[model samples]
Structures are given as structure tokens and as C-alpha cells.
Target chain A: MSPSIMTKGAIDCDIHPSVPNIEALLPYFNDHWRDTISQRGVHDLQTIAYPKNAPLTARPDWRPKLGMPAADANTISTQALDTFQTSIAICNCLYGVQLLMSEDLAAAFASAVNDWMIAELLNKDPRLRASIVIPTQNSEMAVAEIERVASDPRFVSILMLVMDEKPLGRRSYWPIYAAAQRHNMPICVHAGSAYKHPVTSVGWPSYYAEDYASQAPAFHNMVSSFICEGVFSEYPDLKVVLAESGFSWLPAHLWRLTKFWRGLRAEIPWVDRTPTEIARDHIRLTLQPVDAPPTSEQLERLMDHMGSDEMIIFSTDYPHWQFDGVDVIPDGISKELATKIMVENPKNTYPRLQ
Target chain B: MNIQLMDRVATDQKIKLAIADCDIHPAPKSVPVEIYPYLSKRWQDYMETYGIIYRQGFPTGPAFPKGQPNAARRDAYPPGGGKPGSDLDFMRSQHLDANNVQLGILNPLSCGQGVQNQDFSAVYCNAVNHWQIAEWTSKESRLKASLMVPYEDPSASVKEIDLWGGDSNFAQILLLSRTAEPLGQRKYWPIFEAACRANLPVAVHAFGYGGAPVTGGGWPSFYIEEMVGHAENTQSLLTSMVFEGVFERFPTLKLILVEAGFAWLPALSWRLDKLWNRMRAEIPHVTRPPSELIRQHVWLTTQPMEEPEPREHLLDTIEWIGWEKLLFATDYPHWDFDEPSRALPIRVGKEQKEAFFLKNALELYNLN
Candidate 1:
């Protein structure tokens, strides 16, 4: 996987530009929040979603000696942009704002993360775009934040974690969805947790490996929720991007959902088309951390099972190690499929990316 | 059990293997009465007065009610008007004899797994254990029982396994895939320990009403979400067991996933191995790679099979998962039943087909 087959102008759908520390976000915070955070003597709110030194958290060679990896726009340009020759990269700053218990604090921290993303990363590079990190604790606040920052063309999507306080498709969150659709932004459910609930329904898993492995299934349930909750019917044009969610489990998942929908469509009559059709039209997934079979033939067949090349967009999940070397694209994907994934699908997914 | 009642004939492929259906549900005609003959009088009276509560909301029904009545194929209901799988004669005609099933393992989903009353749960499980033999397995030679135990109470679970574990008629120890905690936790190990002593494999069927939300985030809207959630729940448990060293602790124990889809097997194995390779110190008990552990220990039944648009893609996954690890299952009488003859890929060679249809179940259950 170390060799470069990647062509230029590929749009990396998900890349995390880590906030260096608590100090970096302090200026973006309001006078009340800035002094309140300092008065309380708080430290970096970075959740253990990614351990600082874990190999999965950061590729060893990409790690800086001084601070958090990919904390700066310069490192991202050289390490991700120049290497993959990507024209545009979306900075989904996964700092721990959503981890706050108090809705006010969550809103404050989320606002700070968004502002910092604009000032520190998105503005610094013409190639960098970002998702507006919303305070998911309260829908009104989340929507307010969306309205505030969404006007900036640099922000392409609304960022929410996959594992959150409630299923993201519930009625309570409709306001946020309404705001996102009104602004022509997709809801990007990135792979992270709010820590409010166990990563698994059974309870918290013992190892990070178990937590990480649980993400694909989490995506399965999330997609089902969105489709069955009539999120698509309510807002027909809205698209949801499952960032850092693996792809292999999808064909079977869609099959299962659509199969049941045939017998059980009456339960949710709004789902007029097959669930697979709904997903293909509205949902998209990132390419890196590919949880594919060992052979290229198998990978190709698996992608074929996706029923459309348009559902997957190009992503390196940069600075974090998904695969070693430049062989970012899985070996067996056909040149035509690769071109569709790299250029066309992404530009179509994010209107701003075009 | 009458041979003359058999409606359908076996295909040559089925006849050669003497195919086994790994998942067969055996419910009671009436909840307490059918089981009453087996239970002690005190528990019977207790059931009559209070009844069982699953502890999740809605005492009368499942948390997420099924779209179909009894969650069964409409054709599965008996002509005499009882729940599906309740009458042996109807089952023999419709499923067993019709499919030419050489051996069928009864899953009996209503076997007191999610019962709130632990004391009553223990006794109810014990009663169902006897009732299965009396009602179906004892009468039907082609059928076997999945020994029911109160998994919520492992000590009691061990007691149930102690009584029926050695019986060949009872093929495997039944535990739901969704438990109160991850199935791999040490609290549940004693059940596995008892299972090993009896030389019975633990089959984690895809049903558990352990009062937990079906999904990690929160409750989902529809039954469709719950239906797709089986794979997710099972995959999490598989990861939990591997990382928590359930396999290493009980090296000989085997696991079977019933009604849980197996398409994600190859990817999960790879992901688990990749993650565990870098984080071995956290769980030193798992000496081998997670994928290797999965290969040695885990097996899945092909039912509600992954029907990708181009069907051979299913075969491509099975090729990676290895044909030997799969056991053919119909999830008999369920609405989502898979007909064995049509379910498997046509491209698979005869030898691999034999392994999937018959050999895997035989070797896993140690039945002839």
C-alpha cells in the first residue's frame, strides 16, 4: 500500500487538523468563556477518541516532536496535500467540544473549535475547507451555530459524531437538519463518541480495538435510523457523509434493511424507494481505513455490491495512518472507479468543493 | 413426526449431505400451560399470579414489536390455530420432513433469556428445557434442542447446562447474541466453562431483550433498524470476546452465530487483527491475532443471507471467510427464512457445498 497511484486534484473528504492545545481555542472563546475556562484551570479538552501516541491516532513518521500531529496547516499541506497531490482537503477538527456535560459549555467550546478552524486552518490554505462543528447537546444551539458559520463558503458540511447523546435522526434534532439542508450542507457523521453512552449497546468495550471495530456497525444503525426515521423524506435533497466509517459491511446492511422494508414498509410508509436506493442517492462514505477483503478481486466485487460508485468519495483520513505509503487507493479498484471516487463523486457531494 | 406428513421432497444436493438446519424455533402453544407440565407447582402458581416481565417497557410485547405476527412466516402457523413452531406435527410437515432435514437444532427464542425475575427465570428455563424434549425433540427424531438456560444468571445457567449438557439430543448451549453486558465479559465465562465440560458449543442466537437499546447511540425508530442491528450487536460481542480473551481462557470452546449475517466476517477479522497487533499489552490474555482466534473459534449460519445484487459477490466473501466456517441454516419458520437449496451460491464446488450444508454442523456439534 506504500506506492503512489493517486492522481492529482483528488478531494480528501476527511482530514483532522488537530487543535494544538487549549490555548489555541481560548482566543476564539467569548470573554465569559475565555476567562471561565482559564479561571477553572482547565486543560486540553481532546477526548481519548484518539490517544496522542497510538499508532492508529497518528502515523509514526508524521508525528511532530513538539505538539499534536497535523495541528498546523503547513504540516497538512506538505504531508497530506503534496504527498497525495490532493487539490482540496476538508478539516474536520475533532477536538472534544461535544464531550462537555453543560450545554452552555458545549456551545462555547464548539463555537471556539469552529472559529479556530476558520482562523488557524481553513483560512490559511485555499485548498482547505471544513465542516461546522455544532454543539450537539442542544439542537437550538447547534442550529444557531450552523446559521452563524454556514454563510462562509469554506464550511462545506455540518459535523456531528457518529456516537452521540441520541440517534442523530430523532425528531428533536430536526431543527439542525432543517438548518443544514436550508444552507445546502450535508450532515457529516464522523467516527467519534460523546462518551455519554457506551460505545457498544452491551456496555463500554475493554479495548480501543473493540471500540474502533464497533464504528462500522454503528454506521449501520445510524444509516438505518436516518432512512427509517423518514429523514430522507422530510428533507429529500439532504445528503449524509459517514466520515471514517468503513465500507465492507454496507452491502449486507443495505440488503438487510431493504429486504425488511419490503415486508415492513407499512411501519414507515414514507420510505417509498428501496433503502439501498435512498442510501445511494443521499449518503456517502470516505475511502480510507478501508475495511476490505484481502484480494483486489474481492475488493472490486465488494465495491460492486455497493450498487453505485457514486456513494464513495476519496479520503486519506490524513495525518492519522489508514494505510502506509501512497497506495491510498485499494489495489484492485478499476481506473474508472478510482477516477469517479477521486474527482467526480466528491465534487458532487460538496458543492463548495467544486 | 409422521413420515407420511412430509410435504416437500429433498433436492439431490440436500439428499447427498442429509442437510441440517442450524436454527429452528420451538415455541409453546400457550406460554405457562405448555411449560406448566414440566414446572414445579410453586413456580407454576407464581407464574399464574404474577407472570413474567422482561423489564424493558411494554410488559405485554417485545420492545420493538415485529411487523409480522409472532415474527414468523404467515405459512408457519399451524392449521389448528396456534403459534408457529408450537406443534411438532405441523413443524414436521412444513419444515423438517418437507425440507428433508436430517437434523434440526431447535432455538426456542422465548426460553426465559430476558426474564426480569431471576428466580422465576431460573425455574422457567429449567421447565422449558424439559418441555422441549417432551414436546418436540423426544417425539421428532430428526430434531435436536439448543439447551435453554437463564444467561442473565450464569450460576443458574451452569446448573441448566449441567443437567442437559451431555445429552446429544441437546446439541448446543443457547445464549442470545445481545446480553446485559458484552458476551465476552468474565461474568459470563462460567456458562462457557460449563459448556466445555459437556463438550457443547455455545450458539449465540440473534435475539436478546436485555433492556439495552438495540443500538449504541439510543433507541431506533423502526423494526427495520432492529433487524439490521443484529449484525452490529453480534460483531461487537465477537470483538469483546476476542479482546477479553474468552477464547484463550477456554481454548476448546466454540461459538456459533445464528441469524446474524456473516458478510462482514472477513473485514472484521482483518480490522481486529490490525488493531490487536498494535495494542497487545492492554489484553495480554489474547496471545494470537484476533483474526486467527476468530478463524479457530467462531462459525456463522447462512440465513437471511447477504443477497448482494450480483449473487456471486456473496461467494467472494465466503471464499475469504472460508467455506468450512459456514453452516447452512434456514432460520426455519421465520419470515426471513432462507431455503437451503437456493440460498447457497451455485458456483461453489460440490465438496465445499457439502462442508457448508452438513459437515460444519456435524463437526461443530459433535453429532454423527
Candidate 2:
């Protein structure tokens, strides 16, 4: 009955495999990319997207003396997998590949990141899975990248930034979704952005805290765009995993969204079912950084509002200081709900995992 | 016949709380031109020649598409053909009188608070305040108006507050949640200081014509996105105000966050307190716990009331946000307006119902 009782063999739906530097990716890259990196002097194009030194980016204990925090497979395994007894951990590398301006360079880096992820992390651990990072700036190139990685069973999903060049629901992005649906790859919309626009609608925020808090609204917008633009209806089989996007806000958002959609349904007649039904069917949110109240009872109340336990998939958000040391699953979660979040929910969401 | 008689008896037996609707949005009868009378001839010519300029490049309208025309309920439009909230008689019959509302606070969102031209914004805001007094409050004794001010220009805003703050007809200083800068920034402290001096609680309604997107990121793709987007902006503003020591500077200034439902309050407050505990060194000016400041200075209106699954969760959240801080709101004429008769949960005790529906707002605005 205790909240801390670990749900053994749980699946960690989100774990970041830090790309140490551009130089670290040299081996996976072709000779042209290697020479281009050297010629251009592309020294760590890593952005403040996940600021390297941010306390939230990496726990103090997880930090390595040198290089990036989760640079080594051994470190991630010890800190994330072994510690949580994770049966599977989906590696989502949030490097600045999407931030690159040039399509060619962005495409090249995306491939190299995936290749490096497989070699450095997935190959080392059989239980590890990954989301294929795609060049969102170029839809065709993004599809090409998805096609290239489709055969790899370890690559369970296609990773994307929430704030891209355009809303993900726009037709321009359909090819990527089409490729994902064809490959049974769920589109994983991660918390960080491509910085295509100001983090807030008003303009850039003055503080990192503002930027951090902005992620929820970004996710909400993306979800709205997806539902309104008929993305879920168009690609019926397509699933979305909102990674590092907290779960507590979902119930309220869905409630408000459904309320508006009732009066506004005529605007988008293509959306046949209710907004909540569409979201409940297609969307899955990761559970780390739960963003719930301090106590277990409060968390239970939030979960009750969410309506169903199936929407939350377990995630440590490894190397990120979301939860304290062994409190991977925050308080207020019952053992039954924890089991669903950690095991059953992830399996139901990721078709490839099954 | 027996069932009908029983139903009528049950309805008659139900208790009705003295309702103080905190967020009643009264639209202009026609257009922004309604305020032209209160402006100077030169300014009137300026308004006629050039329209209000917002900061963003998007077209002048709501960001997302609405389900109804002007996003108002179909039943709310007047029979004579005007905007939903524009017709005062219709509003009273449909909302105030029908609901037995004791006091209705008018928050006119169309006053153009986020105009880039400071002087024009001030003039427009002043006109809107006068219009509210003339068009709504004076006509209906149960109604009260919020003093409108161009928040970007602190001196002008203060001046406007001083001009209208003493009026018993106006209960609070009206501000849009989405301003050019976070409301807590020192640039805005002057208005807060003026409000404190006038003993007027600053009321921030969700959404504004601020050229900024409602979210921290840019404009949302859909209206649905924009619809749920207010909470994020509200959260940032709340954090900015608390962390920047606005409360410490003006201890008497109270804030009422309207239309941005209360469910997020407990979580946001907890998060702010958590971050403040660890990062207190960064903002040493914030003397007390962030949660403590929130409890002391902030009040939230209930509209778009959160329908958590079990429904009991909402009651628990209200407990987290003290019952005394909740003000009942209907967001009248809009499609999602809550009927006061059925807005609160049925199980609520009469005392709690009275506190939420009337007492809290009365205390905040010094109605008693």
C-alpha cells in the first residue's frame, strides 16, 4: 500500500541520451559530415533547449565529472534502468538537430544522432528503445529519415519538438505523419522547441523558469492543433506520446477543450467524435515531472480527473531532476495505478513494444 | 401531475445564495467607436483616420475561430440585433435578474488594453471606463464597473486609476492577464501602488488583445488551443508577480484572476513554492514563501470550473485554494457561461456556497 513500493519491471517511456558534442557523433557520420563538422567548426550546437548546466537537465548525482551527464550507456543503465528496475527505457535524445537552419545539416545531424543512439545506447542494452529524431524543417527529408529507421525495431517512434516551423497538424507535416503511421511509429512530441518562434505568444520570456513553465502550453497547443486539423481522424492509427509534458494538466485541458468544441464543432465538422474521445484514443502522456500536488491524496484527485489510467505511461525523465532520488514514482499513486502507468499503459500505447 | 407538483416543490425549497458575479463582460453596443464621444476632437480624428494598433501583425480579431458568431451564445443575442453583452436590458433579464445576482462586476475586454500607442491606449481606456459607468452601472444599481487603465504606461495608468479609483461605482482596476510585460515587472508597480492607495483590488480577466500569443510560445494553431491557453499566461504572470516581490512592495494590493479556472492554482502554487525553496537566492527580494503571498494577495473566479472526473477532486482543490479566495463568475453572454443556480456542486453546504458565490468577492471589494 505504500506509495514508494516500486512497480518492478516498469517501462520508462522517456530517457534522454545526451549527445556529448558534435565530435562525439563523428564516428556514426559519413566522411562528408565529419569533414563538414570540422570545416564549419560546428562545436556543440547544443542550445538552451535543454541547457547543459540546468539543475533540471541532470541530477547532481547523475552528473559525470566530464562530458555530458548521460553520455555513457553505463551511466544511464546504472542511474535509470538498474535503479528503477526498468524493463524498457525509450531513449529520446533532445539535441539541437532540429534547431539547425540548413536542411542538409539538420538531416545529417538527425541521422548521426539516431545512429549514435543505436550504437551507444540501444546496442548496449536490449531493453532500450528509441524514438527516431527527424528533420522537421523538411518534411520529405524527415520522411526519408523515418523510412531509413523504420526497419529498426528498437526505434519505436518518431521524435519531434513541440514548437516546430509550423503546427504539426498542418498538411505540410502530413508526410512525416503518413510515414509514421505506415511504420506503426507513434509521433513523440517532446517538451523542448526548435525555437522557430518566441517561447511565449507575447515574446521571449525573461527567465528559464518562464521557458520551463511554457512547455505545458506548448503541448496543449500542439494537442489542439493535432485534434482540430483532423490529424487523428486522418491517420486513425497514429498515436502521440507527449514526453516530459506533465500529466496533471490533461484533465482540465480536455474538459475545457471539450466544452469549447461542443459549441465550436461546426467549425471543424471533420472532427466527428468529441475532442476528449479523440485525445483519449490517440494521446499518451509521460508521468515523470507529474506536476501534481505535494501529497499522494492530491495526486489521486488529479488522476481521478484524468478519467482513465490508460493515458499515463511511466517515465523517469532520466538525467533530469524531476523527482527526488528514489521517488521515481511520486507519492499519492496507488500500487495498481503505478503498475498501469509503468507497465500496462506503455505497452498499450507503443504498438512496437507489444 | 403528482411528479410535476413534487418537482415544483423541490425547486421552491432549494436555497439561493446572494450571488456576486465577479466577471460580467459587457460589450460595446456597436463597435470601438462607442468610446469616441469621450475622446478629444483631435484624437477622434486620429481614431477615424487610423485604427488602434496592436503589437502583433495578426488581423484584428480573436486568434481562433469561434463556434458562434462573436463567440457568444445563440440565445444571448438581443432581439433588436446587437452584440450579446451590448444589450443591458437583455443581460439583466437573461443573467442578473434571472439569477438573482446582488452585484455584477463589468469587465469590458474590448477596451484595448494592449495598444502599442500609449496615449491612444490611455484615452481609449478612459473612455471605456466612462462608457461602463454611463451605459451599464448607472442604469443598473446591482452592477459595478472595473476602472480601465492602459497598463503599459504606468504614470498614465496611475492617473486613470486616481481619476476613477475613488468612485464607489467601480469596485476594482481591470487588467488583462496577457500584458506586454509580466504584470510583476517594476514598470507596472506604479499602477499596483495606485490601486493600493485607492483601496481597489486589481482584477485580471483571462485573455486580452495583447499582440502576444496567449501561451508562452507563439500563437496557437487552433481556437481550441487558444481557448485552453489562458492558464499558461496566467501562471507566468502569477509567478512573475510573486517572484518579483510585487506583493512585498504593495502589501494591500489584491488580485482577482478571472475565467482562468482554479484547478491549476494548487499545482502552480506548489511548483512555485518548490522552486522558490531551492532558488530563493536568485530572487532575494521575495521575502515570504511564494504560496504564502498567493494565499494573501490572490483570488480566483470560478467559471470554466474544472470538471475533474470524480468531481470531488474539484472540492479538494477548492480546499487547497482556501474557500475565502474563490469568487463566483458566470462569464455572461459567452457560450460557456455558468448558470449561478447550477454552477456550484449540489453537495456544497449553504455557508460554503454563500462564501464562494458572494461573501468572498464582497470582502475583497469591501462591499460589506
Candidate 3:
């Protein structure tokens, strides 16, 4: 079911652009990457290589026809605004763009992508906002790209694929954070469609579903790394949004991480506040692909640990298989709290919205 | 034959239908003042130890929310709640009546604490086992017991098993799921071998009786989160037993996994078979499919069967895992214990219902 039309603006923090065809947009990217895509070796992107301005096909799913003739500003605007009724859509580059470029070339490709998204997609619809993609594999280039796009109001935050090279807290990536802080934008860390990292200490996960179930462990490590390395301390005003990550795992991670911190405070004396305290202040988490959606009782128990509603921000990793629909938000939570998750908390983080 | 006489006489074929709970815990009435009663006099004199005690009913530590002395600690400590740390009257009143089962096995919470104390594990385990026999197990006809042992010290563990074996009421040797080493290793053979000779089955229960660090981290504040992933520990336990040739060496030995729900068995079975075939060269002794050995010797309980998928699906899972291998359990008084009648709903058709609820447990636990 569709959400009720909001009397006030309803900001959508996440929206995935479905790419069912990609043959058209290949050449729109710079010609310097002729050998790069071939060397990267992701066959799926290569097989459906679309040429620039070729006639777009309406794939059965409403994914973008990348190599086909572009839908002009008006057609794209109507679908993103009138059809979806989203006041602001946080758009990003094509998910597979990085796979085609080396770490250095990826930064160039990222700048090219931001240029395309800002000029074509964001410029078309007043409601659409963009998250500037960075070449996460190379921090220096990523910082440069962030600074270049920092002045653009259409660009809201730095979009990070969770499995990107180096977690958010690594010293090499500090410059990228400095760039985001300089521009007053948050970093939006979203899950990627990769599971090559060791999800848990136990062993490699046995099934595809188990791998999906392990997003918490990944998010937990990122949160721990951020807190332990004093990332939040360094960037007191900068916010971090764990997008497309589930909410239930947050309370457990906060409790355990903070409790361990109490026993071993010497390990990280710089982290003055408890992990939860740091999280409530500088961090926000979204709730799509909620691994263990609680019953009313479970929700109350979880809220007890979370202590405040502001800790979570609402998101639907849209058009992906595990998206949350309108009715799934239970009436058990107070309307004010629900509104905070759905709108207010996100506004606090992504301030460039209409 | 009278019930007591028939209990002794009934063979595997008869299946005279006694519902036996393979796992149940009886917490200590009080942590004993004297930890090392049997230590050499010289050693005892040298060691006047600081053992944890139950002030109200929970273990006393330095303090609570603050590092308050005992006076302030009393205020913060949870009111000596349900069953007073495995009080028998509480177990019988809350569990026995609710489950309507014939027998309840008493596992000890402090047994793990004793095991962790290293030097004190042996004497402490002996004292707790004797206390269970005299106070809890002997008091009720329907109440049986499992002997806890000093798991780190294998010979001491075996001795504890032998001490309890003479008593028919002691049905199983209780092992904690979290141990220093895998049970299948050669180091644990003394304990398993002793269990075989004593004619007592081995039951491994989860270690989270009171703040035993769970697998991945420190203790979970909520019990539900700690309990959900318990089956993985049990799977580890079963793999250790099967591949270690515990079952192959002692053909009649039975291994029971307590409190870990039976739902994981089907998926685990498939995965084990895959691993056993792939790593067959490493474990030269385990020639057969791991599933076959598991079916032959291992059994599991269904306690706190949280939110079962449709009854048909529940039965479908059982069918896939061989229904006869499961035993009904009510992990009663521990906050989230399932009511047997409520948990084992009569939704499944009559034939499979009796097997899961009563018959299979009786056959496996030798409580005919």
C-alpha cells in the first residue's frame, strides 16, 4: 500500500535506481576508461554495455535503460515526483560504476557520475536530491571529489558502499570525513551486494540468506571502528547515517560494545562517551531489511535499551527485494516517534532537503 | 509390573510410555560455605577461599549499578525472584504441574561456577551432586538428576560420574556447552568413557545459567537474545561427539542436547554430511554420513518453541529430521520457558503428536 499523501513534505532518505538495461550510458562516461571496464572483469556490466543516447527499452522491471535514448527532464521528473510522491529522493551513481574502474580511475568515474546525476537527474526534478559517490578505494581522490561537489546544494552526503575499501574509521579516510565536515554534509553508509569480507569470527557463513542475515555484524564492526578510533570525537558536528542497515541489531551492539568498554576503558581513553551515547549524538540508523522485526513486546524491550526514538531514522532501500512497505510500521509506537523516524531525524542529518 | 519395577524392567521394544524430561535445572539452595571439604588438611588450612554466596538468592558480587558495598548492593539486586535459584518446591509447583510430565531432571547452575574455579571444580561438583541426590532428586518420584563434573580436569570429571552412577535416579552426566576444548578431542575421552561405563547418558546444556559469556561476546542482558542462537552451540557439541568417535567407541552411549530447540537439526544435518564427505581424510574414523551416527546416538529437546510456523510446517521439519529423535522439554521458571501443552500443541495429527510429546523422550532416556 502507498503511504498517505503528506500534508507536510515527506523526505525519502534512500531510493535505489533500478538499472535493467545499461547499454546507453557507457559512452556518457569518459573515453579514458576504454580499457578499464575490460580489466575490471565484472561480466554482467560488460554484457549489457549500453551506448550513449540509444533508444531506451522499458525492461519488465522499471529499471533504467542505461545505453538507450534518455527520457528527457519532464518524463523523469513525473515518475520520481508524481508517481512516488517523494518530496526529496537521495540519488546516487550506478551501483556497478566502481567495478569497472581501478582505485584511481574509479575517482574519475565517480566525478563523471556526480556530474551526470547532478546535471541530468537532480536538475530535472526539484524534489530529487543527490548523494555524491566517492572512489572509496582511494581516499585522496575521494576527498578531492567531495570538495569539488561540496558547493553543490543538490549533493547532500557522501554515499559509501559498506564493503568499500577500508571501513569508515581508518586513518586514510579521515581526509574524506574532513571534506564532508567542511561542506557540512553527513556520510551515508549503505550496504553493498557483496559478502567477500569475513562477516563473523566463527567461519564463512553457510548460505546466501545467512550472509544477508550477517549485515548486523558488518554494521557492528563499522560502528565499533568509528567509536573506538574516535571518529565521532574528531567530527563532533559531522553525522553518520547507517542506511539500509536493520534497526534491531543496534540495541544489542550498543549494549555489548558499551559494556565491554566499561571493562576495558584503557583501550580507548579518547572515547569519552559510551558507544550508545556517541551513537545518539552523532549517528543515525535506518530500518530497511529489518532482520528481526519485533512483536509489540519485543519493540518495547528494544526501545528500553535505545532510550530515545531519535536513535533511528526511517529508510526503505527501495526497489530492492527487502523493502519496507507503508503498513509495516506498527501502530504500537507513538505517532511522534514514528514521525521522527519517518521525517524529522533524517531532516536533522540531511539538511539540504526542501 | 508395578510402575517402579516396570521402570527398571522395560526394554527398548516395550516403550511403556513414560514422559522423561532429558534436561531440567535445580539451582543451589545456597552456595556451600566450605568449598574444598575433601582437600588434604594441610591444603585446606592453606586455602581459606573466597567463594561466591547467595545473599538473597542471586550470587553476590562486589556490588551492583555502582560499586556499592553489600548494603547498597541489596537494593539494586533483583528481588530474589522465581523458584529461588532452582528451589524444588518452586520447580514442582511451577514446572511439574504445568508440563504434566512424569520426570524432571535437575541440572545445576552453580555447577559451571564450580567448574570455572579450576582447583575447586572437583570437590565443589561432588558436593553439588550429592546435594542434588539427597535434597532434590530423592524427594520426588518423578524427579531425576544429571551429575555435573569438573570438565577441565577430565579424571576428576570421571570420578564424579562414577560417584553418581550407583544411584538409579541419576540419569545423565551434565556437561556445559561452552568448554575449554571440543568434546570430540582426545582430552575429553576420559569423561565420555566414564559416562559410558556408568551407564549414564551425556547431556550438554547452554552455559548461560548466570552470565557465562555467550559465544560471540560478554553476557547478554536479555535472556531471549542469548537463547535464540543456542542451537549452534549444540550443533558444535554434536559434531564434536560424532567426529570424535564418542558414539562409535561406546555404541550404547546416548548424547542429549538440552534446551537447544530441535528446529536446527535438518539444516545442520545437511551441512554436516557435506563437511564429513569433504573432510573425510582428516577424520579417518567417521566413515558413515554424520546424519546416520546423529540419528543413532544423539537426541534433542524442544523448549521455548518460540512462535512455531504453522503446525504442518513444524511437523514437516520434524519429518525431515526424523521425528523419533526429538524429546519434549519445558525449560520452566526461566522467564521464557514453554508450557508443554501450549508448546507441543495438538495441532499435528494424533499419530506424530504422542511421539514428540511423550513416547520418544521415554525411549531415548530409558525411562520406559
For every candidate structure, what is the RMSD over all alpha carbons to the true structure, in angstroms? 3.9, 3.4, 14.3
* TM-scores for candidates 1 onward, in order: 0.94, 0.93, 0.50
Worst 10 residues of 3 chain B by lDDT: B1-10
| Higher-scoring candidate on lDDT, 1 or 3 | 1
Q: What is the C-alpha lDDT profile of model 2 across A1-354, one tens digit per residue?
A: 343667888999899988877778899888998998899888786777667777777888998888898887888888889988899999999888888889999999999999999889999989899999999989999999999888999999999988877767777899999998999889999988788776765456666666776677678777778898899888999999999888777776776677667766777788988778889899999987777676777777777777788899999899888777778777788888889988999998888999
* Better model by DockQ: candidate 1 vs candidate 2: 1
Model 1 lDDT tens row, B1-368: 01121123444334434688999888899876788888888988887787777757676677788978778898999999888888889988887777778889899886777788898888888888888888888898888888888998999999889988668679888888778888898899999999999999999999777666778788887787888788888988999999999999999999999888888788788778767776777677889988888999999998878776566667767878888999889987888888766676354566887788888888887776
Model 2 Cα RMSD, Å?
Answer: 3.4
- Candidate with better DockQ, 1 vs 3: 1
Error of 2 at B278 (Å): 4.2
Number of clashes recorded per candidate: 0, 8, 15
Show model 2 residue runs off by greater than 4 Å: A1-4, A30-32, B1-16, B30-34, B56-61, B79-81, B308-310
Q: Candidate 3 residues A94-165, lDDT tens each?
A: 355444446766676677667767667777777777788888777888888888888889899988765444
Off by over 4 Å in 3: A1-7, A19-22, A35-84, A97-101, A193-196, A291-294, A297-301, A323-325, B1-368
Residues forming the 10-long window of minimal summed lDDT in candidate 1 chain A: A1-10
How many collisions between residues are there in candidate 2? 8
